[model samples]
Target: MTARTFQATNPATGQPLSPAFPVTTPQELASIVAAASEAARGFAASAPQLRADFLNAAAAGIEARAGELIAAAMGETGLPEARLRGEVGRTANQLRLFARVAAEGSWVDARIDHGDPSRKPLPKPDVRSLRVPLGPVAVFGASNFPLAFSVAGGDTASALAAGCPVVVKAHPAHPATSRLAAEAIQEAAAQVGLPAGVFGIIYEDGYELGVQLAQHPDIHAVGFTGSRTGGLALVAAAQARDVPIPVYAEMSSVNPSVFTQAALEAKAAALADGLAVSISGSGGQLCTQPGLLFVPVGQVGDEFLQQVAARLDATPACTLLTGGILKAYQQGAAGHLAKAGIQALTQGAATQIGAQPQLLGVPLAQFTAELADEVFGPISVAVRYEDLTEVTPVLAGLEGQLTATLHATDDELDGLSDLLHAMGTRAGRVVLNGFPTGVEVGHAMVHGGPFPATSDGGSSTSVGSRAIERFTRLRAYQDFPDRALPPELQDANPHGLWRLMDGERTR
Candidate 1:
């Protein structure tokens, strides 16, 4: 059976973009999954050097097509040229970083304990362990971050770096951008002489495709970034499979920011300005956007909110990613306004399809459980707390988040040691004094969190070199001969890696 085709649309002008993407038929999807499943063995067996080369080639391919990728992404996403260009650079850099990770080889976490037949009553057996690939992965391209989190995004890079094949399900909102990015990956794989199925891209707008992809026997793992409903759907599909797979879904967060009396007083103007950009930047589509902010009631009181309101009043209107996003934002904001204790501090002025930044406020007692919910567009709620005692409970009441922030002063830290601990416990990352919008891609970066923030179970990130670990699992070898042992575990140290030998660290 022939599947329908989906055309991309320009979010900026709501016009159709060229190069319609075809949805895969069940037969075709089966073929693609079969190819990837067949290719997974060879990909997992391929030398780390070869995989590194492929990643480097992929980086080069993306760099070579920077202009075209950025242009298409800008047109489809309605993001500024500068932002699109930066995203392309980030994507290319991320690929290179993973390439370095592949070449360095420490990502395998190889450890060897040599046979110690001497001391004890019983001799210890030689034991060696290292991580290995989990086979093919199904990566869901996110709509908001077309370049950085889509087709050739971190999920694919990490999966491939871990020696797993990847099949990308392109986001409908930016199908054109996804197609171009996927082409770069394909070309790079071909250049590196990797199997054609080592990387695959499928374009589909419906949930059926996603459900099938998740349920496919060949797909060993899943990676996704989107709304809670979408993420949960994938999770449900994967769980219902005969052999359930891990689905790393970065779903939703109300990344809450709490203000200290000192920090707010000192950085009030600056915080207002920075939060304004963070909340609305990229049409307020960022997963890390501060959705809820907390302020002390008695000390800062109405003055702090008024100051923030004035600054936001100056913030110019910007277009949201899509009409649906705008509508959701409007509905969410309207709901906040109608709630019992919440008041519309600053209502939006936008008549177009753009986001008119809005701020809602409620006293500590009246701040309901619903206030913690994230409004996807350029809107946030300010919760006023009476005392530090009330602060922790309110913060603890919110669900899991990607980030929780504290704008505490040096003097405040003494009083806030417990509060800071509480904030860090609830969030994946705790921001000390700055905004939570900008998430850096690094080894220590924890982009994933508990529950609704992510499906990773607070153990991994979709961003960083550590992300490669998610695509792999540990394999142990016991009592293996020197000649037959893998290079990473052999005494000759062919790979020259650091490992624990009989409890002593060695190279």
Candidate 2:
């Protein structure tokens, strides 16, 4: 039988884009996995500088084709030109950042302990340890981020930086964009003299191909960024494998933000405006959009809600990334509105072109278990609380979040310390007097959180320099000749990398 094929569609017009991509068959998947496995041996043995060079070349390639990439992404994702342009730049910068980490050669956390022969009683054997690549990795491109978290995004960059071959399952929403980005990486590999299987991309409409990729024995790890159901599915598949591999899946987060009485009194207007933009930006498709907002119940809080409603009333509707996402957003938002005591603060006129921005209000007393769920669109819930203590139970009931933000003054902080601490414990990153929609890519950024926020329960991150750690495993060599030791762990420090030598950090 012939393999199935699919095409991309312009979300704005609901018209299909050309170049139908063939579905990756089981035979094709097997061939790809076999090649990746063979390539992993040489790729893992390659010097950090070589891999770094490849990453740098890939970044340059993406930059060279920025216009084409951004145009393709804009049509498929229904995102504005400025947003898609920024995403393309972020994607290239991510590659260069990982390249820097790879070239530095110190991220492996090398450790060495010299043997002691004439000590009190027994001789201590020399031991050295460093991180090693976990072979080939399976990456699932995200529907939300067509570039920065997709085909040549952070996952692929960090995996390659850690010396692993990568096979990416292109997100069905933007296959053409994925193809462009994948081609850039392939060209970069060729220019750097890397093997053909060092980077690969395949297209499929549903979850079956991705599940097979996760279960493939040769795939030593998985990187995913999507819904909780999808992430859990890959985790289960990886666990069911004959030899289980790690799945670093960043799933869901409501990203609740709390406002203090003082904050509302001081700058309720500014806060309301900024938050409206954050919630409605990117059609509310961002993973870090503040899905929930808690505010003090009073005249100030009531007025603040009115201001937010006014801003949201003027906010325009936007086309979602895909038709399925649009349907899901409508259903989720409708479910929230149907609950008792959930009043629509401000709602845009519904349109066939896209989703409308919505703001719903409810008292903390009427909060329900269903309210904690993420609506995943241009929608946010504002809960009124008489005291911070009243929100404690609600906080406790929430799943782990990617971020928890506090809008407060210095005086109010002392009184809310316990509440702040609670937020910190439940979230991967805590923000003070700020919103969580825009995520900064850096060494200190933690994009993963506990339980449903990420499959690993905050043990790993899908962004930043440390993201390379997800594709690596620790290995130690004992009583071996210096020649046999990896350069990072060598006594002479051939790579000139920082190491924990004899329990002391040194070069």
Candidate 3:
């Protein structure tokens, strides 16, 4: 039987791009998994330097063909050239950052408890531990971040850095972009003399292929970024496996942005303008886009909202990444306004193809939990609160989030300890006087949160250096000969890693 093929569509024009990609058959999926399982042994055993070199080479390959990548991505994603270019750069830099961490050889966190031969009439056995790869991984490409979180994105980079072979299910939204990135990684793998299965990508437009990949016995872990439903599906598949594996799925977040009374008095216009940009940027497709805005209930708040409405009114409609997304946005916005007490503050001129940004408002007394649900486009809900304390309950009632932002003066913040603590409890990252759309990729960044924000119990991140730990598992060797220990844990410290020796940290 012939397998079905899918083609990328130019979201802006509703035109299909050239070169359709075939969906992976069950046979092909099995073969890919088998090869990756075989490659896992050699790949995981290779020295960290080899992995680092491969990552660097992949970054270089992507850079060499940046123009081609950016062009293809623009057509498929409807994103501006500047934003796509930046995404490409961020992707490359992310790979390089993981490469540096991989080569450093200390992120594995080697720890050794030296044997005590004569301690209180009892001998303490030596125990050494370090993180090891969890074998092959399955990565699901995300639609919003076609480059940075797709084929060779953070998941693949961190998995490969941890010495785990990766099989990525290319996002159908941007298959061409996925192919280009996959080619770079494949070239890098060949140049580094790694096995063919060290990195691979398959294309499909449905959920079955992704679930199959997650359920594969040889795939020991999964990385995903998408809707709550999609992430949970992968989680369910992994859990149903005979040997369940971890699924580090970053799912959903309605990143809440709050404005204190003082902040409104100080810079209402600036705050309104920034929030408009944050909500409408990239059609509000970002996972961290502020979905809810909290403002004080007063004349000042009404004035600020009016200013925000004007800015949003003047803002032109944006072409979303997909036609389906646009439809959903329209429907979502209409449904939101249909509810009692929920009124549309500003809804830009409607377009046949693009999404018109919208700002809706409802008093705290009528703010239902359903209203807080993410609309997934250029839309935000304005919740009017009588006092800062009045909104604390609302915050507590909400689900986990990627970020919670506060706009307030220094003096206002001094009295916001309890509010700040509440925000901290509900979100992974808290922002002060800044929007959450611009997520920085750094060691200190926490891109995952509790529950529906992520599926890994919020203990892991999908970005930064610590992301590598998601594909790793700690192994402790007790009472083993020095030669039997891994290099990082050997008595001689051959890897020159900083180890937690006995009760102190040392090299």
Candidate 4:
């Protein structure tokens, strides 16, 4: 009967940061989706360059308001100003990158096959295919990447670029930032002459509205970035629909890193510092954070653990993203410590909320069972192994991960090639001698994995140009005349881009 507003609270101070706006009810969500569906029809008919202009304008808007957005993100998320600023840069860069890719017009994978007049018995038919918008898309905001994975983030940008209207479900953790970003998108849409309903944000406190949106008949696809439980719930909801739609849900992972003997022997202390920063950076809130680490046994391994423990002791406990996240992190850390074979190698004294980082460690065997799970906060488990022989089995036991890192020297890489291959099979992306925290938004990055890592491995990342594929569908224009061909697939080559011709790659 009445609309309820969702409040945004400062994680650090436990104070109300801003007044809330009216939450979208199921009926409102339906109306929004309907409007988006209608807008998507007309938007899809517009030229690709026009869509590019909107994305470019959106990027400029985001950059102009970077200060306000970053401050609001920090105030609500308890993240440092520098981190928020960097995230804002990532968000804007992602939008611009998609804009460029969309403007290039090659991602559609347009193809044409000219009719063969001299066929054996029958004349060949002209065949053409191109990617089209799947229609209205429902995006679930991620708590971790408040800016880059939220309202004006990659999911929304790529979908819009692909000609799909986006209806975002705001994450409860950073409602203020979500609303601000939504306003930016709305302004950008208006400036670019796009329909107002092309982008909508539903600020619902409960998850039911999101469920309804996912199952809505008009919504052609769903893009999500969140926990396993939540992502799976959306997948189930989508499946229950009369005609199931694809749901691209990136869930949780314990992104594991391996340290070969040769590399550790060469730079044990340096690796220690790098791992500490990677594990503790952003309070270990990043999905790509190295949660499980496998180290080779011997003096080198012992030294690595000792250095890690010392660093853990020195580091202080920082406030998590929210009170709920903090509580969960504390419980997870305590549970691992209480396991039989596990020992708290080092435990930092808890600091005031939003003060400093928290660090903890456990033995290899116990951590294998107890700490393999993601705690989603500032914590990591050092799982030491006797040799490379034991690494595969340990990694094999891990759930799906967004990334797996191998710190190996040139000589060690040859011997560990099998292990790396196996890790690659299990993870969405494999890294060598690198931390996974700084995920580059490029063509090479694969930010999804199996099972709990993501619901659909085909569409995981919200960064880079690959993201546009999620919001598009392929359509074959059989026996179509040359005059009726889409602009990207016309014989005249209006876009002047590469395309596949009769199974052959060509321009």
Please identify model 4 stretches exceeding 4 Å from their true place: 349-370, 458-460
In Å, residue 237's CA in model 3 sits off its true spot by 0.9
Superposed Cα deviation of residue 62, candidate 2 (Å): 0.9
Task: List clashing residue pairs in candidate 1.
Answer: none
Candidate 3 lDDT for residue 57: 97
TM-score of each: 0.96, 0.98, 0.98, 0.96
lDDT of 2 at 395: 78
Candidate 1 per-residue lDDT over residues 1-507, each given as its tens digit: 455888877866778878777887778788888889999999998888889899888888888888888888887778888888888889988998899888788887778776778848999888899999999999999988998899898999999999999999888888878878888888988988998999887878778988999999889999999999899999999999999999999999999998877787787777777877887787678999998988887745577778777767677777777667777777887777888888877856444667677778888888888888888877888888877678887777678889998887777788887777778778899998888887898888889777789986678888889999999999999998989877777788776677776677767
Give RMSD (Å) of candidate 4 vs. truth: 1.9
Candidate 3's C-alpha runs over 4 A off are none
lDDT of 3 at 406: 91
Q: What lDDT is reached at residue 153 by model 1?
A: 89
- Candidate 4 global CA lDDT score: 0.82
In candidate 4, which residue pairs get closer than 3 Å at backbone N, Cα or C atoms, i.e. clash? 316-357, 318-356
TM-score computed on alpha carbons, candidate 2: 0.98
Compute the lDDT of residue 479 as modeled in candidate 3.
91
- The models' CA-based lDDT, in order, is 0.84, 0.90, 0.90, 0.82
